[model samples]
Target: MHSYGQFCGLAKGLDVIGDRWTLLIVRELLIRGPCRYTDLCTGLPGIPTNLLADRLRDMEREGLVRREMTPAPTPAAVYALTPRGEALETVIAALGRWAAPLLANPHKDDVFLPHWLVLPARLYLIDRSPRQAPVRVEVRDGDHRVTLEAARGRVSARVGPAEKPDTVIIGQTPIAWQLLLGKIDLAQARKAGLEIQGKTTALKRFGVRPPTKAVFISP
Candidate 1:
């Protein structure tokens, strides 16, 4: 951990979260809700065990995260963000908006996580509907499902099954992102073997107007 002896707030803030992957750990916790120790390890592609443990410990000390004993059907120790930590959502949203351009072209070795799309999806979602009836979208990729809700002039996405989804979009992350951004159309996405069902018209609110020419990324 890099310690800044200065008394400034930004420096003080960074002292706790400026470590290489501390904020990202917060990102996982925020996106996934309460997570087990192993869940953090799995969600983060390349984080080492010791480092993850250390970060969690440091965060707990800094009043960012706290351990809880979940009760009932699945009683287990889990980590959830404190209110102070939940405050980071706005920070993360701002960071994601700032970093959106870089996502246009990812580096060869860049690590990718499907749930990472949650923040940006919330950020970039273009809701064209006049009436906000609380649309629900389930982004399904393999065994992972991210629930998205767009209503009340806000978009919120959660990592898990939805209560009752109005539209279920099943597709690869990259293609789905592109489709949602209007870089591709539903037809093209379906042609690529995606399985989308329910309220197709309402689903268009999440995507941009399809481009005239489809842009394909080479394998």
Candidate 2:
């Protein structure tokens, strides 16, 4: 890690977390609290094992993460963000907003996860939504179910289902990403085999307008 050698808060912060996979590791930990080493590896596809180990060591030394041994369902160790690390949520959220435009043009090497949509959904979609109910969303073929709760000018996501959802979106990770980015309309996707249960109008509060259905009459 290279440091600016200057006296600045941003520089100091970057000195600790400016590496390639560091923030992403933090992001995963934030999204899914207290992850086992294997869980982090599974969530972050394509990371080298040795590099992950090195990063964990560095983060622990920087007071950004801690390693804990638990005795539940068997003995195991897990890594969780420290208080200082938890404060990075806003930074990650801001990055998600800034990076929203890039999602429209995905790169071949770019990976997608259903839970990743939650950040932008919290920023761009739910924050603007007029409705303030907790919505449970299911991402088909993955373990990325999350409930989005809109409250006080912003929305936040929690892993797992909401007690009662006004709407539920069922689709693959790619489709979910597009929907959150506003690149594709849910109604159109639904017509093309995407599955959704619940009222379409319920999403209007989130700035989602299902495409107008087209009807054809043939003689």
Candidate 3:
């Protein structure tokens, strides 16, 4: 609850989200939208359970989030951003843009890539397929959305469950970064016996074509 003098908007805003963990928590919610406590903990590595609980409580008290009961008999609740909290999305996006180049390097430690990619993946539709109708993939330790249904050759990307996908992407490292960094070409990776399986046409739809003018972090 530290406060800056009344006149400084930036300082006052930081008063609510300036704590070590608060902005990180806010970033997750902003990127992933509503999430359960478990999701938060899973997505954020190294945060202790007790500290997370305390931060959530403080966020709730500060009106940055609203906790709503789910339909489960055990009375589970999900935390979602309040209007005030949602307003931070722009700030978060700016931070991501600023940090992008610092993360693009392949030789750097990959620990932060997952968190870094989450927001931009959502923003840029990096996992989405425009050429196919239903392309579903499940990251072993990632969030679950819904299954996708596509014809043999159409572009789409769905998260969550599927019988099997043409190409199953698996990594804790930023998939987007891996694609962009030239560490591995999708075709080359597949040719070298990566875990790809299914129609080649379907797989082709997941190609990475990052914008030519974008800045990225160097190793």
Candidate 4:
């Protein structure tokens, strides 16, 4: 709720969302859709409970979020973004793309969730073969798994096993990223503890290719 007392658009926007953990809250809602308070806590690692409650209250007042009561056997309250808040998708996507290189070397203690790869996967995996059948790539890292699908010149990701995967990539998260982003070829990724099965062409269809000037290569 802090403001710079300015009338500019960017400044005005910041007045609402520039607070710590604010946009990340938006991120959770964006990725997870309507969810309960407990769901938010799971996605957000270190946010204090009181701070989350306060932020939710402030966001509600500002018309960025709304709470809904579910009906029936599993009746419960859920939180979802208002249309106004949903409009921040472009801003979040742009920010994520701008900050992608910072993911090159994660700290050892940094927490990671498979669902988080959804955003970056959509950003990077441009389908090169729209005419072909959809390609489903199941990525397994440690105990987590996510499925990335490419069809009609776009890609989408979700956390869980794919119904009928065209390809399966098994590796630690870092190695998996390197493979997906074309930082390493399949052979190199295999040497680095990565494994692949099923259709290798699926990777190519998902835009995994040799590093080139046109591609955003991580440092």
TM-score winner among the candidates?
1
Question: Can you give the TM-score per candidate against the true fold?
Answer: 0.87, 0.80, 0.66, 0.87
lDDT of each: 0.78, 0.69, 0.60, 0.82
lDDT of 3 by residue, 52-170 (tens): 99888888999999899878677777899999889887888677666656644556543452444445543333433555466554332244333323344432333345676544444
Q: Which rank order by TM-score, best down to worst?
A: 1, 4, 2, 3
C-alpha lDDT of residue 5 in model 3: 62
Tell me how many residue pairs clash in candidate 2: 0
Q: For residue 21, what is the lDDT in candidate 3?
A: 83
Clashes of each: 0, 0, 9, 0
Task: Please give the RMSD to the true structure for each candidate, in Å.
Answer: 3.7, 6.7, 5.2, 3.2
List of clashing residue pairs for candidate 4: none
Candidate 1 C-alpha lDDT tens digits along 11-91: 998998899888898899888889999999998889899999999999999999999999988799999999999999898
**Model 3, C-alpha of 12: deviation from truth (Å):** 2.0
The CA-based lDDT of model 2 is what? 0.69
lDDT of 1 at 135: 86
> Regarding lDDT, does 2 or 4 come out ahead?
4
Question: Model 2 over residues 53-153: C-alpha lDDT tens digits?
Answer: 99999999999999998887797999999999999989986776566455555567666666655554555554454345544444453555866655555
